[model samples]
Target: MAGSDSLFGFGKGPPALLLFLAGMLISNIGRSAYFVCVTWIALTWSNSARLVTILLFTSTLAQFLTSGVSGYFADMVDRRRLSVSLDVVRALVVALTGCAIAAKIGIWVLFLSVALYSVVDRGYLTAMQSMIPALSRRRSAIAANSASYLVMQAGTFLGALLAGYLLHTLPYGIGLFPIAIIFATSAVTLSAARTELSDPTHANSIYSKPRFQLRFMYHLGRHRLIAPTLIYSLGFGVGFLFSSLLAAYVLDEMKGGAVLFGQMESAWAFGAVLACLLLISGAGKLLADFGLAPLLFLSGTGLILLWMIPGPITAATLLVALGVIYNASRILMDARVQQTVGITEIGRTKGAINTAATGTGLLAFTFIAVAGDTLAPSDIFAQYGLLVIAVAAGFLLPALRGRPRSHDEDRSA
Candidate 1:
């Protein structure tokens, strides 16, 4: 009876929820630090931009390649234990990598180590996602995810904001300390959390040989849920890809450097934080229940404008608006995916969905950083905006066609 859902009325109580938020905040702080680490380290080491992007790409590429396998293992494994151990390993790996960089180790070795860390890091996240549904009851799923995302947005903004200051003031080697500390904290918190009650649903597996792998390709081809989710991911990723190129447009072509870039990222982060706050305050449920499609269309339209617009002030305004709407839509869609899919295929369902998004990012990064370098920024943004609009159309038209006769009605029917 003590282990039942009465404690929180629906799912986990205060203690488990606190731990969950802490874990996500710490993990996301590490991720945010790592995202900016490449450019910072490159500046300190006098490395090529290509090399920096290559290292970042190496990490994403490895994660993309292994994501499906990681998801499969997540469904089969003891996710909490797997998550805890991996965090510990990641902390040690990152600390050692930091030390090596401080000592001026071979660049190739540094890259290889970071790549190895990426695999572990992403693998742990996959396991964690699989575990969340187990830790909390079904009714609390949305709250849990919203809380996690809020923490993540805060952590990411704080990390990136601090990194900007630290790279200027502190030595690059010393800058990695915060990342190490966060992962260490995450490891400790998760290990302690293991002593709590294990939910019954997740208790049955020590690697069940689910028909997942055997029937994976067939399910992917036939599943109504998976196909639409992939397309939606593609649309979102394309929008983000265009946004990434927009940054280059501002810095190089707009003739504004650090000052403009800093302003834009800060504005973008602020909007994200404000949006998350609104969601956690119960405003999001109102929006979700009432204006889902119109809001989505607004987000897409905002992204299109954000990409094509010139001038730092104007573009930043558009980006702030776009970022908020985009994140809100993402949260809604992700929840829908979980609700729509068969429980047995959750891992592959999400993995297939994620794969397309991350892959699109890789493609976009490669194209923008490489081709945008050769072309005019105006031309790049113009072309990129068109591409994003085209992708968004695929999602928008169908949803409209399937839209309920009234706002109060469910769109899924």
Candidate 2:
């Protein structure tokens, strides 16, 4: 997968590939900025653990609602054009959000902007998800995915680092305006990436026959592997989103204010970076071939262990270790699924996964919100840990009895 044939099925050179990679880099940066900015804003506005959980959960809920529609359109329409358009749309939304925040807009307006941003951002990502298969060979699919994940994760790590530094040096909310610029740059870069038609026969225009039907979603949910994979994915999402609130948790319980919390977040960012690197070096592939279920189960277990730690050093170490399994399972499982499902159903399946993930996240967040109000911090983690264990058991039992022999043989053979 080195030459133009590797880059595009049509033997178009490496320039487009480079451009595509660059585009993803910037997009990931914008996404990372929003994550950091939003979490910081929530922390500043309200210290209640429940409020933070709801805010975080609401963002994903918005995406879950739109992911199906976006995936439908991505597969049905001209994926490349749709991808670029979504990026531009994301830039405009981010810019408006920055302007609104700077002008002291109402809290509702800010919330709306954040919600809208999540939809557009995920819409573009869904498009990009479909495009990876379209742009590469069958064997190259995993490689392209791995490369994209690495780039995306690296961008996020850097963006979070940069944003955290800015927050420390400048006044509060200053990072938003600069983050808008990053989104704008991403949109332009993505648009500039030439979309060589996959089929030499198809026209290179944006307008295409619109295909909308409820069956796409229905069929997606009905697929044997996809449906079960999605259930497992939902569990994974719940654990990940729950763990992400650790920063706020630390601020409240660990005697660390904003500054110390930021540092811990930076640690999380670096941990993610390390995890991505490990996956890119074949750790993910190994896990996919060996024990995806156990890996995922342990990932959740790691989250529980991390929360149970008494000191910062041990907590940080566990957090980083948790990060490793979390991302490793994600990369490997997604790659395996994509390879198994093939390109035809990629969008539908990916959309289903996204929808389930977002939906699960929303439910978990809602629960956390209610629990946050009533339970002590330690109690909240303890209860969530139990939930994670139950979910992990669900996946582990299935893996033991119903391994993806059909899917694995297809990939291996």
Q: List the residue pairs that clash in candidate 1.
A: none
Best by lDDT: 2
383, model 2: CA deviation in Å?
2.8
**How far in Å is the alpha carbon of 103 misplaced in model 2?**
2.9
lDDT of model 1, residue 237: 59
* Candidate 1 structure quality by residue, lDDT tens digits, 267-316: 66666666666666666567566434455446556655654666777877
TM-score of each prediction = 0.80, 0.85
lDDT of 2 at 167: 62
Query: For all candidates, what are the clash counts?
Result: 0, 0
* Candidate with the greatest TM-score versus the true structure: 2
Off by over 4 Å in 2: 1-12, 197-213, 221-223, 227-231, 238-244, 342-344, 376-378, 395-413
Go through the candidates in order and give each one's C-alpha lDDT. 0.61, 0.63
